[model samples]
Target: MTFAELPRMGSGRVSEARRQHFHAQVQEVVVWMRQYVRRLGFAPVARSWLYALESEGKITKGDFTWASKWLADRRKEGLIPFELVGADTTRQLTGHDNFDEEATPREYINRQLRDSLEQAAMYWPSSYWKHQTNYPILWSEKKDVLKLFKPELPDAIRRFAGKGQADVNSRLAVVQECQWAQENDLQPVILYVGDHDPSGIKISDGIAGNLRQIAKVEDWECGLDEMESDGRIVRFGLNADFINNARLLWIDGLETARDEAKGTNDLANPRHPDHGKDYVQSYLLEFGPRKCESNALIANPTAARALIRDELWRWLSYAGHKQWEAENHDASKEAAAAAEGIKRMLAMFDSAGVLYNPGLIQSLAQASLPGLPA
Candidate 1:
């Protein structure tokens, strides 16, 4: 039987088959275009361009114009995002015949490395340039793939270990340098720079601990002592002091630590002394009353009261009205009362132009009181 004489299928069945075929074709074309664009740094041929190519066997002025308009329309309708390809620009370069394979491997590597470096630099600021070092060399042409350290290079070199790869030798070198500095009576200081997350803190702690042990054995002061004395260490950044000084107080857990600290201060000096009251007050007011309950409030009632007063003073200073009542206010309403108190305190800060990031506050608050309603 001839193809034209073949019996026709039901309209519904034919439509379903056509729909499946069209979907498959579209998916195939999308995948191909994605690969082609990534390699050629531009979009592949549009539908009209493909049709023209199949019809005319080459791209012409009229075909190019039609394809451009078709692609523009698709883009306008959000069907496709437009991009220029090699073919689009090459048409302008009349003297340029074709791409040549004469480019050296070194040139290509250099170009790629430069581009990668430029992209990486965007994550950090220009101030980081002072800490940049030439060590921890990235070796692209070696079995090991990286030359971690060179003995002749200066100590305290900052190096990038590509994703998932830690430079053990470089870390060991830092440890060795710390030991040497201690032996030579040179104060050893190692400032760790990493993300402000838990893993980063742990890594820094491990490094500091190792250096401390090494310094003790060698009877030398190692790791930041010298830098601190000389004022070379930046107080900011992810340093040991910054981490240690940080108080991880949450709204719910405030009473536990505040009460403990207050008890210690009260027991240490029971004479009702005014000294150190500021510190005690800060703990109670900023962390205790708002976040914790009376029972959970730190044991030193004096300190707790002082803190509450200090927070009240801050609120008052910022134009937070102590008597301002929230809408539908009822002293008997527990949740509303709590929320009202918080809003009043926050309003004080807001009035004073002190903006607290709600997202961060919410996150920390949630972490502190996992079961409490936000």
Candidate 2:
């Protein structure tokens, strides 16, 4: 039985019939979740999965907290594959022991050397935006939302601006990126995705100003007006059109950082300190009392990926791809020339009777090489 159906701590026992019903429901949920995840192809975050189920009438909105806990327990018991759920990068393990016990120290050294050699053989031109006039950075308000569509954004720098405004570190990183891009004769641009809410709308609108402010503090002299005039910082998703077309879920209430801190509910409420703000008033007039999160796009992964790809294609032109192909051809020729030089160097070592020495190879793997990081 659900929590609401349970008796008070010591009042009475549950009927066996009700108990059986709860068990049957649990089994049905498990089977449905398996099939659902399998059909979806990619694992969505827990909230998105809940939204999908709710939309299909498999569960009510009230079931979220309990269902999430139940699903997590099942995953922990190994009833579900961990890969069936997207990882939450917020909570993480760091600096932990990550050694492999299956290999001996000598075997590990051999594997490392072989891996390095394999990488050397596969070298290509490393620049992704090499032929593009403008370098695009994919910016999302939420990290979880960004993770949903990040794989399709291969040609852009991915950045997650956490809740509300970006942190100081995030702003500094973008400023440094813009500085480097300008130095290399590239124009930096941001493709933004955020919720369509009071704060979310304003957050995307203020990104250029945020970057410019940080750049100025660092003594960088570049005009961000071009980013605005040329439509560089484009808010491409979670807008009214995308939400309506994608059939996204709209959440009730105008929640903000202040509301969260104060343990209050809606920012549009008269009692809210931020209710009188122009952005809040505008959002309320435009959207009523509901807001759609960018995460709602996670319910349809195919459309989500396509949305990002279409925006990227606008900047990545046909001419750019041809230029990239030409650059790759030249890079491959240089790689072949380097390979010949390496072969000659190895032949000299072979002539000296030391090319096939296993002991020397082991020593070289253990020692730090010259002109490389230690």
Candidate 3:
């Protein structure tokens, strides 16, 4: 098509084609998520699983909201809740509250050695990173994912409120933590997860600025004194591409959000000041104007965990993994060495005439001193 004959969006129906393709992707994502839930054996698709349903038709924001209500309707008609967890297969451990169940001296010594060895083996990554990292890891995200996500969180990383925009204290804390990270020669990374909405896009942008602003006034006598201002926030979830890639169902209510953002349906003049037309349209283009909740990912726990892990594992390396393994070996060896030293001391004392039974000895005097033999 000639330039003059081109469709206003781009080409001879090209813009229309792209828009259609984008909508198709949205529908595909919605359907995939619905199928994903149904496959999980949520027969009649329980009330809780509505946001995940992939429905048929021209997709809109309200379809998702209706899905949830549809699930509720099913429940009202007597549909059971989806079973995400298995039945109580937890076997009860033997109770040891009684003093008679206490460990003997030999057992206690062995237990200590075993525990130290296990910790060395298991926590070498923890140890290696402790010495290796130059920055503190501070992670914050929307609260909804916390349940399926808590298990995947690292023990060492600092977790913020993990819900919504960081509150005033939370924003201030970022500055304080950034200062701490800088003082320690550590790079601070903020991994953010939130909904893919007008505000979600803005949330990542303001955290650093908010921190700097708060710090200038409340922290340093002079504003941003020697502060690196180098930290960054990674919008880890509800990104534009993942909208369909993860098959997130499109929820209704974008109009309300849009209205709130612009203070009107028309984007010509938005009342939100900082987040007016540019902010709204930019995200609309990238995300196809379809919004999703972080919780939608929870429907498929394995995939959700895998997705989150993929993002987090970006922080580590093969070299780091190997280093952790080496640290673990060293830790285990340390434990083994301690056990051997104690064993040798007992064996040496047993050989001495002053000690008949090393286990029976009440004090060091019961046997010859370490340097002095019987």
TM-score for every candidate vs. truth?
0.21, 0.76, 0.55
**Winning candidate number (TM-score):** 2
TM-score of 3: 0.55
A best-first ranking of the candidates according to their TM-score comes to 2, 3, 1
Q: How much is 47 displaced in model 1, in angstroms?
A: 36
Highest-scoring model, lDDT: 2
lDDT of 3 by residue, 1-374 (tens): 10111011234656666866644543443445456545544322232244433332322335556545544443353332333322222343556665533367766655665566555444343453544443334444544355455566555556654455677777777667666766665656666777777666677666566566687666642323333343345667767677677666665434433344445543323444543567777876665545676656655556666766777667645476567677777767776676667666756765784345455564565455565444
Which is better, 1 or 2, measured by lDDT? 2
lDDT of 2 by residue, 192-265 (tens): 88889988899888887777778778877354666678788898988897788877777777766443444566
Worst 10 residues of 3 by lDDT: 1-10
Q: Which stretches of candidate 2 lie over 4 Å from their true place?
A: 1-24, 34-42, 60-87, 98-106, 257-263, 322-374
C-alpha positional error of residue 34 in candidate 3 after TM-score superposition, expressed in Å: 18
Stretches off by above 4 angstroms in model 3 are 1-49, 52-126, 130-140, 144-155, 217-231, 255-289, 299-315, 340-374
lDDT of 3 at 156: 57
* Candidates sorted by lDDT, best first: 2, 3, 1
